[model samples]
Target: MATIDLTSDAFEKTVTADGIVMVDFWAEWCGPCKAFGPVYEAASEKNPDITFAKIDTEAQQEIAGALEIRSIPTLMIFRDGIQLFSQPGALPGHALDDLIDQVKAIDMDEVRAEIAKQTDEPSDAD
Candidate 1:
């Protein structure tokens, strides 16, 4: 599958609100980014149900800044408006595939339970 060109203005709609959107933060001059390109594309093709996008750090500085993308070829996974994972460095084809599979297998009910636990904590002053 071809990489979706993501711009600063389109980040929210494309990745945030979209279901299971994976954004690859990279730059044209980064060697690791170039190496990971094919792996990212192949995974995208294999998973049509998920949206895959790429944000060029050089071209989309604002988006990169907002996401605090400090390294090239960072992969950020956002599911249903929540950021599930963000990692830097290049991943092998199989590794990338495994990452996607793991994310898809996550139990959303458990995820929500964890979120509730964090939010339900009482103040310490009491």
Candidate 2:
């Protein structure tokens, strides 16, 4: 599948859907973002099962601000509506492939349980 452009209106629905969703936060003016574009697009084609999307920081400032994105070419991965990975920098093709493998290997049952535990715990503020 090809990468899709994500806008503010579609951001929440797209990321919260089932299956794996990879989001690339980028800007037109950023050198790193330009360099990473092709890498990300190629990965999208390689991983047809995953939803690969991009948010142009310059055009989608609202979404960027809401996500607290401070850097260009920030990559975030979500699986079954749960975010699994987020980091700055452009990943090499090999590293991106490795990351996809790791995300696929994750046991979401364990992840959900962990989330439940954290949410159930008493807060330090209390």
Which residues of candidate 2, in runs, are more than 4 Å off?
124-126
Worst 10 residues of 2 by lDDT: 63-72
Clashes by residue pair, model 2: none
Q: After superposition, how far is residue 16 of candidate 2 from its true place, in Å?
A: 0.4
Q: Which stretch of 10 consecutive residues in model 1 shows the poorest summed lDDT? A: 10-19
Clashing pairs in 1: none
Candidate 1, 41-76: lDDT as tens digits: 999889999999999999999888977889999999
Candidate number achieving the greatest TM-score relative to the actual structure: 2
lDDT of 2 by residue, 52-114 (tens): 999999999988898899988999999999999999999999999999999999999999999
TM-score of model 1 vs. true structure = 0.91
